[model samples]
Target: MTEPRLRELAVADLAALAALEEAGQVQPWPAERFEAVLVSAQHAVLGLEDATGLIGHAVLARQPFDAELEAILVSPARRGEGLASRLLAAVISRACEWGAERLLLEVRAGNAPAIALYRRAGLEEDGRRRGYYPPLAGARREDALLMSRPLTEG
Candidate 1:
């Protein structure tokens, strides 16, 4: 298999991104939503792909001072392959290049794998929102843990 290359995602990639989101997330955003963000001026979408196809992606909403990591996912079958880590690091680099001083993200509290990934990337838990994530199917609603990492080391 070829090594995945990271690149700025385009509007054309939304359908594949939607499929990856659906396979990797409990509640995936509609493809149109990604298109809106990709077309917006203050947001960015990044993706990683190999010879096969898109295997991971990150969506970010940015301002001059900070950015919100709206979503990030690696293909379900590709999880544990360190793809998330690489994609996250790439996003952090891109965010700083875009003049963001910090990057923030919220993840389901019970998502240990995802939480660990953020922690490994130097994002510390800074806040929480009670019952932020709606219940999935019959599962109970879950809290969201807010995490952040400063773009400039200080």
Candidate 2:
């Protein structure tokens, strides 16, 4: 696969982000939510684009001492191409630049690929939330695995 270009998302890319969220997330954020995040001072959103289109993105929320990776998604067809890793790297770099001491995120318990990617990015399992995600089409609920990575002064 060719290397994708990463950039700060533009207004035109919001629709593509929405589409990717809908395709990847069971309980995807509404379009307006993404729009607000894009414009909000506290959020940093990055998009990855290839020849096909927007392939992946990561949204992070900044606080005084920490940043939370609120969402990360890659188009299903583009998985296994390291798009997720690239997105994660971009978010972490932004978080560090924002003076964040740590970066945290939660992944659905069964999302092994995401967990592995986070682990490879130096995050560790810090905790878990039981029944954090609503069931998909049934009564079963999903747990969420909380992970965190600390940033060092450079």
Candidate 3:
């Protein structure tokens, strides 16, 4: 594996990003959605792409006083490679630079890996939304775990 380098996602990367998200996320954002985000000042889309291709990506929304981690996806084949953490750090750095005081995100309750990753990155569970995720098959629905991290020493 080549060393993963992070960069602001370019328009050409949308197809690869969409594929990665569709494979990794339960409800992935379509390519046009990401494309729209890329052009907005309120959104920051970052990607980790090496010689092979895009391995991970994160979409964050910039607010006046906070930032929201809207979506994060790492190719299933690229898990456990620390790409997620790197992408997260990049997003956090961008948010901090933009003067955000906190970072927020919602994760599927059943996504243990993502929950663990966010926890390790200093996020704490602050709330929950029942039935936030639609059922995949049967009557089982997934909750949404709200997580937050303070951006500055307080």
Candidate 4:
């Protein structure tokens, strides 16, 4: 397998990105949504691609005082290969370049691996929204864990 390259995705990448999201996300964003994000000035969509095509992507949004990681997904077949961590590091770099004081993200409380990844990256739990996510297969909702890391080293 060829080494994956990380780069900014353009409008031309919409279809491939949408396909990856469909395959990887339980609640995938529509192609139209991806299109909108692709064209937005405040948003940056980064894609990781290899010879097999797009295998992972992350969405970052610049805010008034910080940057938010709106979404990150790695192809199911590509999971456990540390691709998500690479995408996250890129997001942090981009956020810092934008002079964001901090980076913020929300993850489903049940997503242990993702939470662990964020923790390992120096993000701490800022708070949680109880019953924030709709049920995937049952009636009980799951909480959302809000995490953040200061971009400035101090």
Candidate 3 local lDDT, 95-115, one digit each (tens):
999889999999889889999
The reply for model 3, stretches above 4 Å from the true place, is none
Write one digit per residue (lDDT tens) for candidate 4, span 78-140: 999999999999999999999999999999999998898899889999999999999987768
Q: What ranking of all candidate models by lDDT puts the best one first?
A: 4, 3, 1, 2
When 1 and 2 are scored with lDDT, the better candidate is 1
Clashes of 3: 0
> Model 2 off-target regions past 4 Å?
none
Model 2, 1-154: lDDT tens per residue? 6788999996678899999899987789999999998998899889998898888888999988999999888888889988888888888889989989999888889888889999999999999999998887786899999999898752
Which candidate, 1 or 4, has the higher TM-score? Answer: 4
- Candidate with the larger TM-score of 2 and 4: 4
Candidate 4, residue 64: lDDT: 94
Task: Score residue 83 of candidate 2 by CA lDDT.
Answer: 83
Worst 10 residues of 3 by lDDT: 133-142
Sorted on TM-score, best first, the list reads 4, 1, 3, 2
- Per-candidate Cα RMSD to the true structure, in Å, reads 1.3, 1.5, 1.5, 1.1
**Which segments of model 4 are wrong by more than 4 Å?**
none
